[model samples]
Target chain A: MAVRDPAMTDVARLAGVSHQTVSRVLNGHPNVREQTRLRVQAAIAELGYRPNRAARALVTGRSQVIGVVAQNTTLYGPASLLAALEQTAAESGFAVSVGSVRDLDHRSISAVVERHLAHRVAGIVVIAPVESAGEALERLPKDVPLVTVDGDPHRPMPLVTVDQAAGARAATQHLLDAGHRTVWHVSGPSDWFDSAGRIEGWREALTSAGAEIPPLVPADWSAAAGYRCGQMLARMPDVTAVFTANDHLALGVLRALHEHGRRVPDDISVVGFDDVPEAAYFIPPLTTVRPDFGAVARASLEMLLTQIESVSGGALRETIAPTLVARRSVAPPPRR
Target chain B: MAVRDPAMTDVARLAGVSHQTVSRVLNGHPNVREQTRLRVQAAIAELGYRPNRAARALVTGRSQVIGVVAQNTTLYGPASLLAALEQTAAESGFAVSVGSVRDLDHRSISAVVERHLAHRVAGIVVIAPVESAGEALERLPKDVPLVTVDGDPHRPMPLVTVDQAAGARAATQHLLDAGHRTVWHVSGPSDWFDSAGRIEGWREALTSAGAEIPPLVPADWSAAAGYRCGQMLARMPDVTAVFTANDHLALGVLRALHEHGRRVPDDISVVGFDDVPEAAYFIPPLTTVRPDFGAVARASLEMLLTQIESVSGGALRETIAPTLVARRSVAPPPRR
Candidate 1:
């Protein structure tokens, strides 16, 4: 029987520090104080810890490929993030092999990660956007260079994602600033972190403004769902302003309102998120939030590269803030 | 030095039939005659042509993964196809490894294909939608079981695609049927096969009806481009009906017409393609062409599976016809 090579846990144990601290020292993260760094170095030297994956990659000249694990879907946010990441990787002279899974479940994610490891990928990025993916990320080998995008904020993992809460707050605040007494929200599926974060921000904004929080209208990320929610809201006399989770939802709301003869901005103000390319072409031209997917992609690549070149690191997090793109859809409430 | 294994071409030469016929026989296709099937089997035995990839996969129990090569894009059509393909492949108990390239050019595609080969994927699917991808598809080694989706019609390769011409004709005829004397057309980027096929169908519909052919308005697949074209069309008194290549373009056209005070279906009518999720939510729900992406994905997988289980064959094709989804965007042209 072959003996397994020494692992990151061994180094951490010898160094008298947590696994994350060991990773932080290995990654040369600036926050590691001198004493801890020296302790980690001493442990590494004593154990002959070589960070064999990176070392082997350097010797074999096979570090030009980066593995990406993402769910196969046409939804704008994940699709855009994947595209942006591929572009950024290409620009940096690396090829991307995306192991596309049917779901972000543990079994699917683990299978893809195992395949990536078999191919000797220099580093890995998992576009884990849902709650189910968090457990799998935690269970992955700690020695492997890894990063997560749009994953659980509570997980101790390297992650880069758009500030979903900030964007949602901005959208809600924009609608309230237009003199609406209170704003209603149509949110995305509950399983997604993006959805939860946006819901949080929407509630935060409403609470901060001392406005009554209306009952949440839940819908999946679809124009059809939005239209259904819109139909219900269109009949409500007090529904003066709406902030949807995304632009497609806003389009549905706009159409339902149109069919009911409720004019936009005059009768009801609307704001949306994700500022999709066609948002400006919507009936009233959607006022929406634009997350910096490019910045997030770049930051993710930088973090992954740091791990590939050195070792692992602590749960490094970078949240790119989104800007509100105010278009024609926002206005003061109707004179009742 | 190792001797090269006998390839499919060798078997084709041994048998007096075309490469495609040999493939048809090996796949147990009903079209192959009994005599031809016997001859191909005899040739296979004589040449010791084992279809080594599939045989090895069987022996090693490693045929559960399918490799897919697609460009990284957020565009609706290609993205939908990719998603559907992954879903279909998953249903068949196969994992999908996507090789995402920046371009479908020879270098990028060839590199990805090589990676897939190294991984010993059961079969490969290339989502080649652009003209540039044609040359690379043709250049790949013939022994690999491969299929191309949305590739060039002229290429001698296994391909499965939506019938763009048929969908365009349906959209054009829908407008013509609504009493528009003639329809002005806005097309997608010229380099795409989807664009060319649409132009052909649009022209054929007009010519068949004895309607004067309007000069083509060229634009990329963007709402911004559609807005520019719509501005021009809205200014023309004779432009009563406009057909855009996709739903986003229709949205832009609608917005421009709205801005110019041209009420849709009253002053002018409009039709678009791709029946996007948000199309029905457009101010006056759009009438567009809905290509069956799921059907195309299923057909592509079936074709690839047939080839993977047998020897390489000649070009096989499957073109799924899309349907016209009528909504509020079309109406009779207004009287002068």
Candidate 2:
């Protein structure tokens, strides 16, 4: 009779260690010493023992899948960030399973987490775009390795985010240097940290320049909102310059200005954030702040994986800076 | 002993069938007779024989994981389709593992597929953006359950794609009906079905109307390419109408038209496809065709899953239509 092919048992016997030790080596558990791991590996190679993932998963009760809860519907930041994270995760030999939460309510966020947990995922990355999601993530059990991207830094959970405030400041500063008196603002939704950061940065830039900060108008991150705000700004005799929270809104502002018969740069100078792909093609080619979303995503994925590696482990919060890209959108304030 | 969990042996014993027969019944193999399979199933329930997925995988050599090979870059159609597939796959209790092939070269594409095979995935979905990817996928194993989204239908693999030609036809016909003498075309990379389809539709529309068919310029799906093409068209006194393959190009076209002191609609009318979110914000809001990517994704997932179910031992192919969204981009040709 042909000799039975070597299994984990044969490798364990050859290495003079328990079958569980070989399993640990296969799973890359850090507790095993280097010598023991090498011996197990050599024995496995000699015995032709291939550890089956499904079998190991059954025994160890840990699925290799990582869940990503994102709110990427119709928003540029969230969508781009999620895509970056997916790419980063794929490079690290892990699969990111995504779930979309329409709203950041506690129930919705928590439910999404629970669904991933039911699948026995290794960890989770939450792309929390709303204020409620941060609070909900804090309410979850700390045992699971969790990292929140674009989340509030003040929140207790580990966070990886772009420096929204800095980007906003840069946008405001660009307008100031271009000889704008005061930069009128068209902001995104009120509850998002990103929105708040831009508002704060805009206020800071104005205060530092000794320019009177005008009231900020809030829009729902849509072009129509920016257009309405633009129309309103166009009517104001003293409103010579404006800053928008995102490019889409800036596009709307441009349309509103055109409708009100005011030309871009020549009539009312403008600046927007999120150098979206279409920004460079905006009628006057928008001048905007481009966030280093890829860097932020890579950093976030590394942070999450670190925590996942130390599953019963912890990680530090990281904040990355956004960059500014100058274009044709801004100009000197017209003589008032 | 935890009651030994009623292994397959117990069911086989009760049903007076071989253990392989019980395995075949559980895996839904077609070779099993209806009466005998029913007997084994009844015995399984009576004996409470729960087949361990891991052990069963070892015997049957199948993994439940579904591999989704997609492009890492940003594009509206592929990105939206992927998001929809993720949502649908989650609901069906299957894990979708993503592999991003930055290029569609045979080696790169096959390497991604091999990575999936290494994980023992049950099937794969290749979002073949370039024609080269479809060619690469053809080289993959025939036994693997595979579905191609927006790929060439010439290949024997099951396919799910949006009606690009139909949508393009609508775009071109709309511009022609608006009383344009001839419509100039700016296309995406020729290898993409979308690019080819849009070009073909535009040519067919112009031919049928007895309008002059202009030369086709290839673009890489960026606003910059469209802008370059737009700049050239702006100088032509007779270039009264244009149809671009995608929205990003239309944006560039609009900017180019504006830069050359030519006004939109009043000088030259433009129509774009994809109806990307920011399209409506274009100086004259883009009028384009919107591919129902989500519906296509849902249909693709369902079709692939049906094939898997039927082949592995359950359904049929499903196709969906694309729609057109009209906006301000197109208008009557300017009077001489």
Candidate 3:
């Protein structure tokens, strides 16, 4: 029988490793162990498997495409970040391949990462913000150039994040400075890292001021959730100031306040996070904290490209600061 | 020397054709002419070359991953549709590879499509909504199974879209039914296919009702653009009812009305389209038309998958109807 072309599987079998390991070695992924690299090299030599891209990549040193694994692409925060990432990466002469995951489970993330690997992506920028990201991230091939945006900082990976806690603190402090007795907060889902940061920041501000802390109210980062919280807060006589985790929720609160005969800033002052495009148009014009997603994406892309070229991961923990935009939504609390 | 794997160039030399012709045959892409296919087949037979994925694909006939080419993913409509597409495709057992283009130019779209072809995606779903999409889509490899979501119907590809004209007409008719003499419109960028459809719908409603058609005020789907138009309308005493292309524009119009001391329903009535989650929470609550984006996503996925399984394309021109959600924003015009 005529000899058939040696496939990636053949090289893997000769090297006594998985096909993924062969792919990793061929792609010059930095995370592969020295011993496994030699074994894969020996196998490639013996089998004479001349992968098409391998030769070109040997001269070029890296692929032009980078992969982004983003979760919740429908949400404004994630979507805007993704767009920014793409734009910045393109400016750096790299095309982006995105695989959006519905869940942050280990298997799903692994599968998506593997798909990008198969495409010979030079690096990965994961944008999943759930608490489970650390575990999921650990499962990736160690040699892959990886940087995460909006992941837990406690993890060992390089991270680029928005200072959610700081923004929340500023919002709460702004309310308290306006001389409110206390600031009530409507938070996002507790599992979200952003939510955790915002909650901590709000708590820290309240504690520092010696203001009475209100019971925690949770929302799912939806306007509907904010509206529900608004209805409940409208019934409470002492609730004069409110901080929501995002602008959409603040919108719902404004509507509820309008229906409840409460004039904004006169009856209840509200501050929101995420100065989305429509923030200025909200009924009372939301006073919101703006996270610079473009800056975050640009910074994260820089780190990822650095890792792609260096072969050794570096310590890069960068945070983008959020700014507060003063609008019409804040005032001293109405007289008791 | 160890036996070397045969490269595609070797096959092309043996076949007396270009390397691209060899690749086309290997892909089972139906675009190759019969004579060229025969020559390539003979070349493969003589050279004894078999690609890794091609052999497997011939047996399995489909890839688990589908490709989506979306333009302007940062926008709410496209982002929501992408999320919906990802969820539905996953449930149906397909991973998605997305290539977002900055522009829908033929060259960019073609490059993205070619990249997906290299990844061996089962098919492609394009979500570009610009007027140029038809021409850009024509540049795609014709043999690839393609279904367009929210594209022009005149093109030769299957399309699944929301009836934009019907939705726009509904918004305008609502204002007219509220006893307005004429309904002015704040439109999205004229180049957008949705904008064109909405303009046509709005005009149709006015012509059918015998209402005087006012000049079109253009906005670029941003609140700032809408706010500028709103300021101009606020200065006109004859502007009793207004329809905005989307809810974001309506939000800005509301802001301008408030600044100009014009009450929404009492002095003027405003209606918006796209019942985004926050629309219900807009000041005075926005009355808008709700397009079932999830349904559109689901239907498009089904059609793309069906086309992938079958070689020949089927006729699928599906339109999801939008519904009007009445709220506090519209009322009978003030007595003359």
Candidate 4:
């Protein structure tokens, strides 16, 4: 019969202290007293006990943990991406450790990356949606296994992101096909790559149709901001169609239109991106874009694993296209 | 003048390799060959370079990092708590590392706790809102500084949570105050603590008023489930008031009632919980409960800090009460 390996409980018993003390001593925690540290060390030596496998993996730099850097946010797009990535990593027998940063600036991003590297994580993924994060990504050593999601398109980095422009174009063309001559847009924060890509796509679609472009309405990714912009749109009689950067914005716009006595699809039509789960329950069920977050996660992991196994980094890029879900929110403009 | 501390980049310059290689050697990463490791070590000794403050903190076990264990979910409640906690921690000059789990089962919780211990995190916070996570919390060593958020109330562990029962009672009482004989309820998943607490409060309010207790309409936390239950409620002639466990459920209920030609506040009234950002934009605008997540987070951190400073464990419990926000969704029962 094989001998059973010594456990943490055994170390606790031999050291004449609690398991937590033994853990503290092993981790070099400052709280443990000198006497307790000596006792735990003696016990560890006596039993030939080793710390947990994860600690051992840290020493070997082969931990089955993927480090992710993400902003601490409750927004739908980034939050959905994180959840999908965690699920995908788990399915592939890897645990995810997220270093939550308050901001995506260079200093914050660099600090999180250094900590992740110190832990010797297998690979690192940074969810860089804003332009401020670009400089940090460029500064990191190119030899590290890294990938950026929803980062700058011009950056020559390994990336997997949603085709935001494609989704925007589709939403715009759908409204045009409904006999609307022009479509107004409610965009997200100006600094975000998602907002830039979406604005570009909407413009491309209108230009292709030879439709007149209206002045852009800029807003942050919040319902209150959307409502404020919606109030302005509701006062314009010629604004027959509106496409919002996200579903929450669409909800605000719908509320404003309702308050203004403008019936959806009967007076002014609306379209939104990110078909959030509650979109279908809206007063007039929302027609929106649904990005394949699961697909983006899978592609990201596959690209990362290839780099991890080969011990080389490549400038790979994959963009998943979003589909437009048709619902009651869009219709032909009412006759004058 | 003080001599500047040697940096990682300085070590790289001495080693004649990329900065990443020096990091790998310091982290004990296995990818580097013996020759490279020796060269990096020699350079480190020559330059007297210290890896970084964080790595040094790891040795002393005095890292200013708080480890948080949360399930990988996009659900509004848990997500909001996490985001708020992260913000509070950042304000207090602490970085947060989240270990995302797939389930709240005992084994999963234990594994995450062990990992946090290995990293010597200042303290651990587990966002356990399910029944299965109870046993693991009990089994942990008594000396560790730990606190649970939205965890089992029966467990003898330090915890800070939203007052779910109080919020539900307020919602029910608000409807009753509007001259409704009784209020019907659509609940969340049976196993969740939030659902159970909401049910308890609802029953208490009805019993206190000497009103008939209608059988609960069981549903999960989804607009789809709410819609299904709403369809049944709409067909019942005596249904005048409804209280749902969450805002998304209320949204679905509102949609279903609209489809059935039931005018909100005129034919039926509704109340909800969470007061999600979109609640105010819901069709008639939803009257809901707003749990102070920031307060809960601040209290949790304060309790954890107390324990860490004293190097002791206590069964501290704090529950932050939620307030009801009145909106257009509630009105006096239509004249019988």
Candidate 5:
């Protein structure tokens, strides 16, 4: 007859202990007698037995896990925000598990949620730039409590978000007050709230000042895209001032302007958002609006834990504001 | 009589179910009847019951979790590397927990590890940067298996790291081939292996060329530091070329050069390591060495999992090679 695999029972028998004793040793129970534990461990090691994590989790009925669903795209905001969030969560005795979905389509987003479900997470936080996550949220089972960061406030779920509009307004007014005729805009993808909000603020500033609002050029939040837009704007003699969606884009704009023989602040003035860590090192030391990501991340963790506690015990909502960090990328419109 | 806090038992009694049945319902076990599950959930919600994660972990003897000890500093490599590692761990049906240390000191690093132990992690991945975490590793219980990433290869434990020295060599050689007499150096923190490896590669290239090797100016992987180094170098008439340790520093060098009235490629040429997404946006479009972090991350994960399986199944050593990406920043040294 085929030999039966030496299971926990056999290991327990070999170690002269009960099966429970062998299990205690396997699961890292400190209460086990060291000598007896060693014997059981030796037996198990000799038998090549591996305890199943899933089975253990099922019997316990608590997963000891928290899930974070985030975009794979390397934007400074999301990346930094997550780094801060993970650190905070770990301190609070929670594991910060993560899933990535580039697209906010139902399947992709749902896959993230379902994967978390399979792990049986205590809670889930979705971090994405797209509004489609809202639609995807509706598909989640009513039981799981969720907290979203950098998503739409209009969704029927608890959310923690930075005040994108206020940040944009601060950036735009900084340029407008510097006496530019109308600030040109290089925006991120239309679907992103940050891009749309910045556009609105730029338009609002121009409209309020009675300056003609120029059309915004759409670009992904990359330096290359900004350089392309900067190349186009450098050709326009009247384009003496500009505002970019982010620092990377601004870097591109600066590069393109130099190539076109337009000196920054002499031929044209510029402003950028997201005063990224490297922004101050830009050739002219970028004057950009810095978002208060730390505040947002802290608020997100608080909001998520609150909702998790409330939902598991009982859902509740919270919002946060973004602050502007004034720096050197802005100046008065250059004289013709 | 004084009222006892209604624990899981009270909820189970109120919902007319066994304590185990209540646990199944709370954990979203599919076997529980929907009606009974809803009743138990309602009782739980009404009573404001919250399960202690620690208590549950104690009973189950398995956490279904993994601890990730990473750097708290916001560097591109660590930030992106952490994100990639998290995604991989989550996909493998394990929760990725995180902790960060500002330094490699035993107290700071060990504290993070002990905290993870308190939560009962299945395994750990130490993203140790310096010689410091090795001390912390000694303090940890030997039974718990660990995998180190971007750590010292000579350590007794398994290590997974990217080839920083090779990437630096490629950057220096690229400059030499571009017709530069020799490349000067700007490096990251003295403690980090990345900084040291790049410095070695640069020195090796100069030594092999039989050229005079200059002393290394230390920077903390920031643009401001790079700019300061750049300012000093720009004034040196013989310093016609430079190789910065990272892209952020290269940006600062560009700024310092621009301020010093030196035209890139015309007055001086430069190359940077870590082709950050914004590298091409630099004034002259920085030429940089890009480390294959994705390959490193993938190999690290595979090595880590392999080691875990081997230890559990009793099986060996593994290593991976690094590659480089060449970009625009290198140019011929200007005529004296």
Candidate 6:
């Protein structure tokens, strides 16, 4: 007579243990007794039973894992976002598999996405802000609920982003209201959505106030780049009030202004974005905007999880607002 | 004779494709024509073939995936190290499965290690410097090769660490050589081995130079912490030179001193460690020690990979030297 294959129950019975004990051994639980584990393993070997991960996944039709795709940038924003997401994901009942793309481009992100697919991730959180990641969204598989964190608001699908434009507008308006004729901008890379948003907001504030709009200086989100912009602005006596895309660039501007004998707020009033932890300690202290990344992380997990469990596809698009922390950096433009 | 069970070659034969083509289809190779892929998939479904990952791992006894365990700290040092490690691992043709613990505790690390084991990682790089992580090393599974990046030198297994003591000594010496009576230190958390190394080095430099060793002021490696220490030191008339655990703290000290009406170098010379990218731009610039995290990453990867490939376990214990960058922060104490 043909015999049935050995099941988990059969292995448990042979080991003289409960099914839960056998399962705990298989799961690599540390609480299991060593002697008890050895017995269960021996029983499994004798019964020729295998409880591999892929086999279990195939039977259950769920991996119960989330893939977090992030840019491999050392910028505090992305790093803090990743750390916060990881912390929350661990606390919640889910496992996170992280994949960092060399750049936030379609080809690089897609390649990472394909690798994640092989692991059968239940959902993916793509931290998109680069222009290329916006285009990469089209190539993504729509079968599962995918969310983008810190991406352009215009991008499709469930998205959670910070209000970059509002932040820029507040910064610019602060300078203009303080008696500056106009505010010059030191922006991030043009291809970045954050850069574009900040530039647009700066333009909007200047136009609304009927102030002169000076040519915007471009930077690559580095203190060195900001220093270069500062050197040029320091030479131009008319460039009194300046707004930078982020705090790092602001730092460089402060250094250059100091070297060129242009005192901040006295000679060139300056403002920055992203109140990183060190912003409060910057030379004249930095007046900047702070993005609540922890809130973004919590909101993102809740939204992605809601999509993950529901049979009905819900489109969730939300933006987190940033607040201005005024320090010693900004001052009214000197009398012209 | 009874019909033989379906095999991979049988599926290839039915699809009228080469064995390599079937492999390409199962592995989701993009180079294959769509029609060819469809034909191969149809044959596989007809034969009821399953190409599961865990099953493949059991057969091959090698997963070719490296697991990277890191502390979930937003401090730039750890963040930069993790980023560098990920970048190098990706370029080295290895899949990096990252697992971050809630804290650098043995229980948490063990739990994460269990999850990684399920993925059948070939090796592990533990970026551990906390005391609990050093204790947890003994609990790791002995079958796999494990190495710690920036961990304690006394801990077991292969280790790649920066010479924190040397960095601290140079920072202290730099302050002492500038004609200061003694250098007071603002140290990191005591539980951290990194902090311990730095403290020991500071004490060594003081004892060796016939200088008095003042009380060790402990901190959590934050700029705010440094600011608090600086506020106290700035009030003290004898506190002329101060050495901080990191550049972030140095910034806070600079700010506090400025608030207390004490000018840097002329009033109080300051030095920091981990010459972060923004160090050169701090108010007066910063003279600090620079740790080459890229070199540490490369060395750790080479050691881990060698252990992973070789049956012999070579005990590799090494330390990367840190160089001091002289900047505007340190100057000879003014004549009293």
Candidate 2 runs further than 4 Å off: A1-52, A311-315, B1-65, B120-122, B312-319
lDDT of 5: 0.76
Candidate 5 lDDT score at position B220: 86
Error of 1 at B161 (Å): 2.0
How does each model score on lDDT? 0.84, 0.80, 0.84, 0.85, 0.76, 0.82
Flag regions of model 6 displaced more than 4 Å: A1-11, A14-55, A58-62, A333-336, B1-55, B58-64, B177-181
- Give fnat, all candidates: 0.48, 0.39, 0.47, 0.38, 0.45, 0.34
Q: Tens digits of per-residue lDDT for model 2 on B1-43?
A: 1234466788999999999999899768999999999999899
- The sequence of per-residue lDDT tens digits that candidate 6 reaches over residues B1-336 is 324335568889999999789988887788999999999999998975544443445455545567778886477888888777776776775656677776889898887776666556678889888888878878766777788987877766689999999999998998888888899999988887889889999999999999999998888788888888889999998888999999999999998998898988789999999887888888788899999988888888888888878867655987899999999999998787
Candidate 4 ranges beyond 4 A from true positions: A1-65, A91-94, A114-122, A141-143, A309-315, B1-66, B90-95, B107-122, B139-144, B308-315
For model 1, the docking class works out as: incorrect
Ten residues in sequence with the least summed lDDT for candidate 2 chain B: B311-320
What is the DockQ (computed on Cα atoms) for candidate 5?
0.24
The CAPRI quality class of candidate 3 comes to: acceptable
True contacts kept of 6: 0.34
Q: Per-residue lDDT of A214-292 in model 5, one digit per residue for the tens? A: 8888998899999999999999989888889888899899889988988887778888888888888886777888777
Q: After superposition, how far is residue B167 of candidate 5 from its true place, in Å?
A: 1.6
On the 0 to 100 scale, the lDDT of residue B266 in model 6 is 88
How many clashes would you count in candidate 5?
A: 3
- What value does DockQ give for candidate 6? 0.27
Candidate 3's C-alpha runs over 4 A off are: A1-67, A92-95, A105-122, A139-141, A334-336, B1-65, B91-93, B105-122
TM-score of each: 0.77, 0.83, 0.78, 0.81, 0.81, 0.84
Which one is best on DockQ? 2
Q: Write the per-residue lDDT of candidate 3 for residues B1-336, one digit (tens) a residue.
A: 324435678889988888888888976888999998998888887865644332333235444567889888878898888888877887775666677888887888877776666545688899978877779888766666788887886776789988999999999999998889889999998878888889999999999999999999999888888888989999999999999999999999998998899988889899998888788888778899999989998899888877877765655888999999999999999987
B1-336: candidate 5 lDDT, tens digit per residue: 223335689899999999999889877788988899889999988975655444455465445467788885367877778777766776675556767776778898887786666556767888897888877887777756677877766677767776777777887887788788788999989888778888988999888887788888899888889989999998998887898988889889988998999888777888887778888778887888777666666666666666555555322234444445555656677766
User: How does model 4 fare in lDDT?
Assistant: 0.85
Instruction: Enumerate residue pairs that collide in model 5.
Output: A287-A329, B286-B329, B287-B329
Give candidate 2's error at residue A225 in angstroms. 1.9
Q: Each candidate's DockQ score against the native complex?
A: 0.21, 0.27, 0.24, 0.27, 0.24, 0.27
Residues B223-248 of candidate 1 have per-residue lDDT tens digits of 99999999999999899999999988
Error of 1 at B86 (Å): 2.5
